[model samples]
Target chain A: MQFNANTKMAEVIHVNYLLLPILNRFDIQLGFGDKTISEICAEQKINVDFFLEIINSFHDYNYFPQDRLQSFPLDLIIEYILKSHYYYINIKVPLIETTIITLSTSSDKLQNKYVQLIVKFFQEYKEELINHITDEEIRVYPYMLSVDKALRSGNIGKELVEKVKKNPIRIIESEHTNIEDKLFDLKNIIIKYLPPATNYSLSNTLLIELFRLEQDLNDHARIEDKVLVPKVEMLENQILQKL
Target chain B: MNLKKTIICVKSPIIYRGIAYCIHSIQPGIELEHYNNIDKLLKDDNHEDKLFILDINLLPDPAFYFLERMFVNFQDLTLIALSERFLSDKLAVYFRGSILITDSEEIVKNKLKNIIDTGKEINRTNRKNSAISEREQEVLRLVAFGFTNKQISDQLYISTHTVITHRKNISSKLGIKTIAGLTVYAIINGIISPDEML
Candidate 1:
């Protein structure tokens, strides 16, 4: 049922309950080492929205230190990489590997070829993902957090704040852009996972999983853009006021 | 002309709070006058020869009526418009040719000295476009137009104490020691033309 725009928040929350359990399972599978991507989906029960939210929250939580007193701690940055980047790769790689295995065993040659193409795409996706996470943790998050602390304490001089504000995150976000371009290219190659003739069960399952993964990453980028950058900007202003 | 004591008029509580803060920060010597209505300001015996800070928003419709009255009654009084928003038509018709407008107290103190300096400039030909910082010109024009301290405060959306501080700065910069001195300086400087001077 379509809900009206003016629907109450409580009603929206109630509707969300239908998918909650599936989302909880995805979260648990992603959080724990219990199930591979293929195994998680083989169960045929998952909450797509909740799964996206978890991915988005992981990205946001990593961008800034949750402990206000820690003042943009280093550990938070590492944890972000561990959760959003490393964990994502771990789950996705096995799913692709299993899908490739399932495709190989299929009776139809067209279905086997489709799975082969997906496996190749996942291989390149994993490489790009690793580099993106490393660059953020090593360069971007540290500089941003440091600048935030300096601004809050009023120790950051006017000249420095002006300079940093002008540039903000120079290297990390640029790399992210490059990585996103590659992801887009990969997506185009997959072409919405359209299976050739003779493909049936494997084709449907692969399409479903790939669509879900694409959605999860898109959500991850959005939370970073909206919540993380604004938080950093606020911190920068507070620090500048002190100086 | 012996520089006479400066006087300030204001109207609002929020602006009065800001003015109090500014005064506490920068203590300038001047006499401050507070009034709730234009009637009280106009009825004052000391209206003539005093620098009046008026809140343009407080005046009734066809503001020219009040402007003309002040111009006719007090020949040497300087009027300034202290207001939140200075609409172009209102400014052009009522304040443009006569009064100055300002929004913030800090701008008033910082820019008043420049307005006074430019006013002292004998040849008006060399006057720069922003001869007075926008804020100082605002307070100066309001003072010239006959606004009370409280009225200026309410109109500018600042504190009455800020109006007082702006007035003190206006007096010191013009080297005017009294309200009469400020009025004469304002007239001589052409801040308010002879026709507009009250």
Candidate 2:
């Protein structure tokens, strides 16, 4: 179901618990009692329209209104993007690593070996993921924000313009595919090759976390590719035309 | 008919042990004659209706011609390609089925069961014109179970390129492109066990 400003915030969570982490991105805590999304946004001083669009898109993948999202100030989108990156590096990555460590310690010898291989695979993936995230943080996101700033101020700095021409967002776009492919391979290696674990709950938890991270990352990429990149591209083009 | 005799022509003791263990696990009473060389395997005269698991890597140069000649001489021989890696398509065409040294005991048993149940030669022409050949079905099952292209190729004695081609054909024929979608189809079609999902 497509949630709107009128939809009860609690009802949204009841329908899809996956939205819980996403809600946390906006600092929307669980104590929201009987508050409609509009009411909560007013209470929290969050943008009701932006909240509705983000939640609706997250709730239903097909519900993304790209034009509407892009129309919002790029700052709002980038803030969420930065928060997601923070979540991945600080929360999700550590959580998965600890889960692997826990499962490996508790599993039998056969499953332990599998978990060790998984650790190696995940370590490589983690390095690549962090590198990708660092590239975005250190380079791509800055370029995007600079472009947005230049477009808004109606004045592009000479150095910033040169940087824009040198580093297009397409490089980051291709890296997204590589990181995603590695994640997919990691999941399959565990699913297809691993011997069944004696500590089933721990193994299942690892699987669940991997799947959740994958889905969330894909959604995050969609925002970057479909909404963020195009908006930045438009800004870049406008600035280039002025030049 | 019960599988009365089998021959394994592999040099590596480890691979030989693995194949022997799987065979014994499946049919404990069956006879398995091991030969470390092609000449030794060829010298044996009783080849009718016998299962032969031969390692293509161990075979001398021009393995394809030798394999074809062996098949022609023993029309009833059931040849299963045993390889550490995928065999070239030219060499793979002679086998009734194939198994990898890296294959799980269950996978080895399944391939053996399939070949024994069908008891048919690898008719290349018929497979080429068919909607989805038996080999393609094997590829589909492995693909559904989340085996990568290289893994599927290694297990099936086909090259990675061949695996990709089969995957494309399978996707087109079944109208399913994603691995998850193909997996659901496999579960529905009984290509793999639902219990394996756990």
Candidate 3:
């Protein structure tokens, strides 16, 4: 179901409880009783259209409208992305890691060893994820923001030009591959390899969290690749052409 | 007999669980792996003696090629097409049998039981090629240990080309392509100990 500005805020969560985190990233909280999405967005000073797009994209995987998302100001999308990165690093990663740690401690000796291996594998993935996020935060996002500023103010400064020429957003477009592959492997290891003696409930929880994170990251990557990069590339071209 | 495991690749969680519940009820000790997609199931599984319950609608574009790949690559697999409605005879030819989502629980159990028993009987008579050879197992062991084909060939005193062919047959027979997957399979099956991995 597609959510719109007129849709009640509480009903969205009723449809999919998984969307609660996405709503939280938007600074939306519970007790939005009988309030329409636009009403809550207006109160929080959030862009209603952008909020709807984000919620709809998360709610329905196939509902991402690339053109509509690209039409938003680059900083707006970047701000949302920054919030997502925060959610991933500070929230999702910790939750999954802690769960794995707890699962390892609670299992039998043999299962515990495998869980430890998984913990190590997950640590590697987490490191790679953090590195990727750090690159985007320190290098890529700042570069895109500067380009956004140049495009907005029509002032292509020397530093901004050098930055654009030095680090094109296209370079890291395929960087999501390794992280994605590692996540796939992690899931497969749990699904097919974990022995029958392991804790089913805990394994189920880990699988759920991993699958959620995978979906969230995939959607986030699609936005970055399909929308953010192309928009920034356009801004870069405009700035260079004027120069 | 490779009937100890089953892989269900269906989109609907309810149907997947329902079928799994029936299978477990019928054969409590069976190893069941559930997947929502066909490609992941095919790639990660050890297809030897494993029954695949595939959602017909979830097949990739050019589904015939995928079905053909299963027929050619994995001779030991018993595929059961799953759908909410009846399938045409042409498409139905791809499956050893078809399970309708609308089948009652008892009906489903009987169907699964028949498949499991018949699968074992069929494999016992003429399935020598379906089993992994000793040389192939040695190659798989080294492969899981992160050895290259040349290294495995050298250790086993086989030609590199023979090692490659063995690896191909191992992958085709087992449906496990990644080193990590094979390693996990080796550990689980006791071909390689978890300590060896360390």
Candidate 4:
């Protein structure tokens, strides 16, 4: 879809379903009717550039440039990425875990162990995800911020620049694969091994949650792996060249 | 004054005459070559800075294709699209820095004057060689498909940091900043097709 100032909010959603959660973060209600994206954002006082860049990136990442991205606050991208992380950690994971817990309490001895296994698998996945995000939030994101700061000033210390340039982007990369393995394993376990007789409805619900998480987790990993890692590497390289 | 490096493609004799007249009036000593067919104009590749003006209303498809092909292969050229009415809705998304002008000679003269006055050719040479890298193009292809940075990294087997570096460099080189803008550029530059975009 060719998004412009006059593009309707409803039209964008119609084009890309993935953009729904992105809009929801900005308090953009679905009942916006035929209002143009620019108009709705104006009323809401949202940064239209930031909103457009995020949606467009979600719709298609190739459209954005560094300077254009620089026009909007980098904090917004960081914030958006962080929010996605929060959604997975606080909301999506817990919802799935809660369903697993409910399944455990149901009056079926045979399914109880299976339910416990699923719940335990999810907890492990959650721990890994939390640890990965926390690492990014604590170590990597701050480094990016400092890079942004140095970029703006046009002067960076040799050691500081080299530190970022050499920052362990590779270290965090393996974690994504590990997470993918666990998610994939848990999904296969549920589909192939879980006995669905007693907790048929519950298992179905669990299956649905798992499927959704699987998709969401893929997107999450993509954001981290494709988007975040590349950005930092770029910043690091820029600093290195300057040094 | 020397019309050694410009190509104008317009099928209409009357419109072509008007443009010629306008160019002569703007700079009386200036020289020009006109072609009724876009194919003839693109027949030879010039290494010097060149300006190409296409009448969008006449054979619009080939005109756009010609422009994009020139952009990808030829390197240093300024492209102009002249139409009787605004055809931006259908064509603007594919505009890769091409100046869009209506069929008014006065408007064309004004726009062309700006290009000439700024000495546009001198700068284009510097930009031609700094084309987006192969890796950046790969990042661009995935980005157009809406893969988040991390997803792109996983698929390409590159670190997310490397993907970002490519993206930043891609944006800077293309002079486009939004994902949608980059998407349009990819299509225009033949990096990706319109059908490929979702």
Candidate 5:
């Protein structure tokens, strides 16, 4: 999807009905009095470029404009990104979970077992996903912000920054990838091996929702892994160069 | 299946405490024991199928005397040697009788979960007949046949790092370390015929 500031929200959603949730998330209303996305975002006091970056990223992951991201205020970016995390944790997850329980309990005997397994798999997946973002929110991001603060203040020692660099972050990357893996497992179970023919609409709805989530979730992590990590490393280097 | 208890034998209370903390982090609420003097603890305690973790660097008794003595007494127990240094010849022989050769603390921290998992596997196997995953068993079979880590990775179509991981799992699951020891295990398990090796 070639998303731009002037593109109408109606036109975008026409192609992908799943994008409604993401648009509604930022209070970017559908009937924007016929306003363009950029105009509507500006009206809401949202950072238009940041919104574009996120939406475009949500649109196409491989098209992350790393160059445009440098001028983006990280504080604003992080806040907006953190809100996306809350949207998953507080809203989407519980909604999906309740849907699973409601749908699963209504299944017949043979199907109930499979439905139970699906619910179990999703519960475990939800836990891991929460932990993944929670670690980033509670630990990694705060550390990066501190590094940013230290750099901006011109006082954090080279030794400390070096120490942070020396410490391996592959653990986080592995865990972050683990979250993706659990979803893939769920997807395989749903698409390939799901029990035959009961509540087809409910089952299809769950799969579609999962398909949408997988994209949004991976994009979220891509932003964190690709954009934030490298940007912080750049800040560290800039500080080193100054010294 | 009964949950297995883990015992750590080391001289320094400080280091023992550190190892205990790391183990606890990997697995919470398992039975764990620490003793400067293993013989005394063995005599006093009645744990069947206990898994022992020993740091040979700190073994006050000559490695052979203590390791052999403990093996004789705790026939059902599995042993894992934890240390930073390579084993001395005598110590190496003793390690061959045990279940694992744990690397330094840093490597241990990274591989700790796999270590504990393997120990539990060995413990539950009713002494020396633990079932490894098919892939791990294949790695073990190749390793026993004297392939290098890289060669095994190539043969298995997996990365050298994955081969190393499987090797670690193999060591933890079966206390035999040397190529000779592993060959004996492989033959006993019918992983490969003696005629095939010859």
Candidate 6:
């Protein structure tokens, strides 16, 4: 089922504006406000359906009217994005960058070529990718963390948690489609590092090294996409109830 | 079918629960007891005459301790393996005369019955082969196939002294005095083929 943050039709009475600034500062310090998404969800006994719905809601920019943020728990949603989405990318992308650097400087020519291709791929997609990361960190994660803190301290009240519950995490997941497409494009380009038959010793050595680097990157990306991101989002929601 | 009491000794609660569910569903009139710690289960005198279901994932050290103790203490108890997916491949060479391997509870129940029935049949077929443990059978198979103590140790990844100990146990159990006698007995009991012996 899709999560709808606005479904509860809670009256859009303006709360204190100071709360936003306080939550934003809190989110940055707590690494998306403490507990990880997976741990929170697991602790809260939140179902997979609810988790997916919440994710989808965050990424569904077109369907979710921009003005709706005033009505929705904007701070909490931002925290979710920061911890669940941006945090994983933040941790993984640098590792991938380092791997690319290592592969490029390898003495083997084949390895260098493969690394060069990866570097080029990242360079080409840099704007779109960086923007995605920045948007999550700046906008989505902080919001989610605020909601988490509200839920945990019993300060926000159950009405807010129920409203947040209605909003599916799936919205953000839908936006991941674009992100995944770019990642796949990079992966496809990187796959060319496989060992190719060559009489030249230098080319053959480079190819083997390149193949290994590609494998490492692929594994790194898979862990980020499959495990880390979802877990982080879950944590943000859980922290809402606790903090 | 007579109601047989089965005891499952596995480390993982998920697997243990899954097996318990399957065994309860498939086998009627069978009592299934689950234990995470084999040592605790073994210490209980109530374990007598019950089918012992072991997971190979539970083995190689701490689990091996239980297996060795069981061989010494509970000779009549039939021990069957609820194996990990990879264990079937790893243990295939030794499985011929040693452990009966299965992944599911229903299959384990059926295999346990077969082992019990086969135990009875072996007793009827020849009294001389009645006392061999699964490990002894494994050592016997390796020995019959012409593996020296060191070779057997290397193949099984055990010490040569351990291989020698297994060999000694095989001789004592089967009433065979020499390696040649052990080889002849292993061949007659289908532990190893003549070609394998060469």
Task: Please identify which of the two predictions, 2 or 4, would achieve the higher lDDT against the true structure.
Answer: 2
Tell me the lDDT of candidate 2: 0.77
Worst 10 residues of 4 chain B by lDDT: B94-103
Model 2 segments more than 4 A misplaced: A175-177, B1-198
| Candidate that would win on DockQ | 3
Measured over the true interface residues after superposition, the C-alpha RMSD of each candidate is: 37.6, 9.2, 3.0, 19.7, 17.0, 29.9
Q: Give the fraction of reference interface contacts each candidate recovers.
A: 0.00, 0.00, 0.15, 0.00, 0.00, 0.00
List of clashing residue pairs for candidate 5: B98-B175, B99-B175
Q: After superposition, how far is residue A171 of candidate 2 from its true place, in Å?
A: 4.9
- How well is each residue in A134-168 modelled by candidate 3, as lDDT tens digits? 98899788878888887888877898788677767
What are the per-residue Cα lDDT tens digits for candidate 2 across B130-168?
Answer: 345556767987886788899888777679999999999
Candidate 6 per-residue lDDT over residues A1-243, each given as its tens digit: 233333211111122221222223224222333444444445555433334333433323233232333233444434443444443345545655655565566536744543454565565545666776676556545555555566556577666555456643445545642444444434433333223323345444434444443433343344334444454456446745464
TM-score of candidate 5 against the unseen true structure: 0.53
lDDT, candidate 4, A71-159, per-residue tens: 45556678877887777788888888888888889837745744655665577678887887788789778877787778779979776
TM-scores vs. true structure, each candidate? 0.35, 0.61, 0.63, 0.48, 0.53, 0.25
* Per-residue lDDT over B141-188 for candidate 6, one digit per residue giving the tens place of the 0 to 100 score: 667666689987875657999988988776655556545445545544
Model 6 CA deviation exceeding 4 Å by range: A1-243, B1-3, B59-66, B85-110, B119-198
Error of 5 at B101 (Å): 31
Q: Say which candidate scores most in TM-score.
A: 3
Model 5 alpha-carbon miss at residue A238, Å: 1.9
Per-residue lDDT, model 5, residue A156, is 85
Can you tell me which runs of candidate 1 are displaced by over 4 Å?
A1-82, A105-115, A151-167, A178-199, A237-243, B1-198
| Per-model DockQ | 0.00, 0.05, 0.14, 0.01, 0.02, 0.00
| CA-lDDT, candidates in order | 0.50, 0.77, 0.77, 0.64, 0.65, 0.49
Local lDDT at A49 for model 3: 94
Interface RMSD of 3: 3.0
Worst 10 residues of 1 chain B by lDDT: B121-130
* Per-residue lDDT of B49 in model 2: 61
* lDDT minimum window of 10 residues, candidate 2 chain A: A169-178
